[model samples]
Target: MEVNQNDHSYNPGDIVYVFYRNPHTQDVANVQSAAVVNNPENPGELAIFLYETYYPLTNDMAVYQSEAEAMEVYEQYFSFE
Candidate 1:
């Protein structure tokens, strides 16, 4: 599928949350990061790379299925209420 780069529907710098399970612990890791890239291959999807010390921990790369999924995970970790 071809990604429409001209589509202003979504921006690349938007903040979003993501929920992911750690392969080792089977624990859910919710993380938030800026939207890095969006294209046809990953349409309706967002990529969040693990940062150094403060963010999620990972050596390989990870991407969420959708924005809602990312937000849900982010809320799980950051939201108190």
Candidate 2:
């Protein structure tokens, strides 16, 4: 299936960067490389595959096309110190 989420400017196989908060540590977060893919369970929707998990890809998500871009935003808003 060749699908493109034009609204989000991303499609299956697209590499994106996102902020991943450690599930065990509530305060620690890091930039992670993720892949955009068709959601197997949802069929028509897109999802972000990272760290062995699939997260729903929504318009509100802070997805970045490059690691540098992701890091910039991360430091600006998510960084504690």
Candidate 3:
């Protein structure tokens, strides 16, 4: 999908949080911070800069503006007590 400036709510340089699943520990997940940046591969598009990689911003991503927000959702579905 093509991304325009108006296509997403976040601006470049904005910090965003996301649930990151550990590669080796497939069952483990944690809330991690990522930076919103203009897609270097696709001009005018937005992507999440994390783990030294650029991931295109898509509708399926549950991106959060705050760590608390991310943790809240993470707990809702992933927490077991």
Candidate 4:
């Protein structure tokens, strides 16, 4: 499925959070902050460079608009509240 880039509120060079399912943990996800490295000409395809891992992630992942938004997601799902 092609994602409408316009619908997603993120721009290149913007710092965004990406979500990935933790392979070591069951039923848990990990969040990482990365910079929007590139948005391919093909609509909906985005690449991000992660600072923590020093690698570029191009797989299908959820990208948040801002750190605050990512925090909200983590709090709602990952937090033990």
Query: Each model's TM-score?
Result: 0.32, 0.85, 0.87, 0.53
* TM-score preference between candidates 1 and 4, better one: 4
What CA root-mean-square deviation does each model show from the true structure? 9.3, 2.3, 3.3, 5.4
Ranking by lDDT: 3, 2, 4, 1
Model 1 residue 50 CA deviation (Å) reads 4.6
Report the candidate with higher lDDT, 1 versus 3: 3
Instruction: Give stretches of model 1 more than 4 Å off.
Output: 1-9, 38-81
* C-alpha positional error of residue 58 in candidate 3 after TM-score superposition, expressed in Å: 1.0
The sequence of per-residue lDDT tens digits that candidate 3 reaches over residues 1-81 is: 233332447878888899999999989999999999989998888899999999998878888878998899999989898
Runs of candidate 3 with Cα error greater than 4 angstroms are: 1-8
Predicted model with the maximum TM-score: 3
**Model 1 Cα lDDT, one tens digit per residue, 1-81:** 122222323344544334555657775554545444443344555333434222322223333546776576577665768
Task: List ranges where model 4 is wrong by over 4 Å.
Answer: 1-6, 20-31, 39-45, 52-59
Model 4 deviation from native, Cα RMSD in Å? 5.4
Count of backbone clashes for each model? 2, 0, 0, 0
Local distance difference test, each candidate = 0.45, 0.85, 0.85, 0.62
Q: Candidate 3: global Cα-lDDT?
A: 0.85
Instruction: Answer with 2 or 3, whichever has the higher TM-score.
Output: 3
